[model samples]
Target: MKSKLKMKDEILEYTHKEIENIKESFCKEYEHKIQAVIEEKDKEIHAMQKKFKDLNEENTENKNEIAKLGKMLEDANKKIKKRDMEMYILLDENKKQKEKAAKKMNKVNELLNNLQKEYTDNIP
Candidate 1:
C-alpha cells in the first residue's frame, strides 16, 4: 500500500508540470505577436511623418513663388501709373500749342484788312 501511494503522487506531479509548461509556451507566443504588431505600427508612423515633412516643404515653395508673383504685379502697376502721368503731360502741352497757333492766325488776318483799307482810301 505504501508503494502504490508513492507512484500515484509521482504521476500527479508530472501532469501538473506539463500543464505549466504548455501555459508558458502559449504566453511566449502571445508576447511575440504583440511585439510584431508594435513594429508594424512604428514603420507606418515613420512613413506618415516623412510624407508630412515633404508636404510642408512643398507648401513653403508655393508660398515663396506667390510672394515673387505679387512683387512683379506691384512693379507692373507702378509702370502703368508712370506711363499715365507722361501721357497727361503730353496732352497739356498739345493744348497750349494749339492755342498759340490760333492767336497767330488772327493777327495775320487783322493786318491784311488794314492794308486793304489804306489802298481803297488812296484810290478815291
Candidate 2:
C-alpha cells in the first residue's frame, strides 16, 4: 500500500511538470506570434510613411511647376504689352510722316501751276 502511494505521488509530480512545460511553450509561442505581428505592423507603418513622403514631394514639384508657369505667363504678358506700345508708337510716327508728305506734294503742285502761268504770260 505504501509503494502504491509512492507511485501515485511520482505520477502526480510528473503530471505537474508536464503541465508547466505546456504552459511555458504556450507563452513562448504567443510571444513569438505577437512579435511577428508587431514587425509586420512596423513594416506597414514605414511603407505608409514613405508613401506619404513621396506624395508630398510630388505635390511640391507640382506646385513649383505651377509657379514657374505663372511666372512665364507674366513675362509673356509683359512682352506683349511692350510690343503693343511699340506698335502704337510706330503707327503714330507713320501718320505724322504721311501728313508731312501730303503737305510737300501740295506745295509742288502750286509751284508747277505758277511756273506754267508765268510762261504763258511772257509768250503773250
Candidate 3:
C-alpha cells in the first residue's frame, strides 16, 4: 500500500510540471506572434507615409509648371498685341500716301488740258 501511494504521488507531480511547461510555452508563442504583427503594421505605416510625401512633391511640381506656362502665354499674347498695333499704323500710313498721290495726279491732268487748249488757239 505504501509503494502504491508513492507511485500515484509521483505521477501527479510529473503531470503538474508538464502542464506548467506547456502553459509557459503557449504564452511565449502568443507574445512572439503579437510582436511580429506589430512590426509588420509599423512597416506598412512607414510605407504609406513615404507614398504620401512623394505625392505632395509631385503636386507641387505640377503647380509650378502650370504657373510657368501661364506666364509664357501672357508674354506671347503681349507680343501679338504689339505686332497688331504696328500693322495698323503701317496700313494707315500707306492709305495717306495713296490719297496724296491721287491728288497730285489730278492736278497734272488739269494742267495738260489747259496747255493743249492754248496751243490749239495759237495754231489757228
Estimate candidate 3's alpha-carbon lDDT, on a 0 to 1 scale. Answer: 0.94
Clashes of each: 0, 0, 0
Instruction: List clashing residue pairs in candidate 2.
Output: none
Q: Candidate 1, residues 1-124: lDDT per residue as tens digits?
A: 8888888988889888899999999999998999999999999999999999999999999999999999999999999999999999999999899899888878887888888888887895
What TM-score, computed on C-alpha atoms, does each candidate reach?
0.70, 0.73, 0.68
Instruction: Decide which is better by lDDT, 2 or 3.
Output: 2
Candidate 1: clashing pairs of residues? none
Give the runs in model 1 whose Cα sits over 4 Å from its true position.
Answer: 1-13, 108-124
**Predictions: Cα RMSD each:** 3.4, 2.8, 3.5
Q: Is candidate 1 or candidate 2 better by TM-score?
A: 2
What tens-digit string does per-residue lDDT give for candidate 3 at 40-61? 9999999999999999999999
Tens digit per residue, CA lDDT, model 2, 88-118: 9999999999999999999999899999989
CA lDDT of each candidate? 0.91, 0.98, 0.94
Put the candidates in lDDT order, highest first.
Answer: 2, 3, 1
Poorest 10 consecutive residues by lDDT, candidate 2: 115-124
Looking at model 2, residue 67 earns an lDDT score of 100
Candidate 3: which pairs clash?
Answer: none
TM-score attained by model 1:
0.70
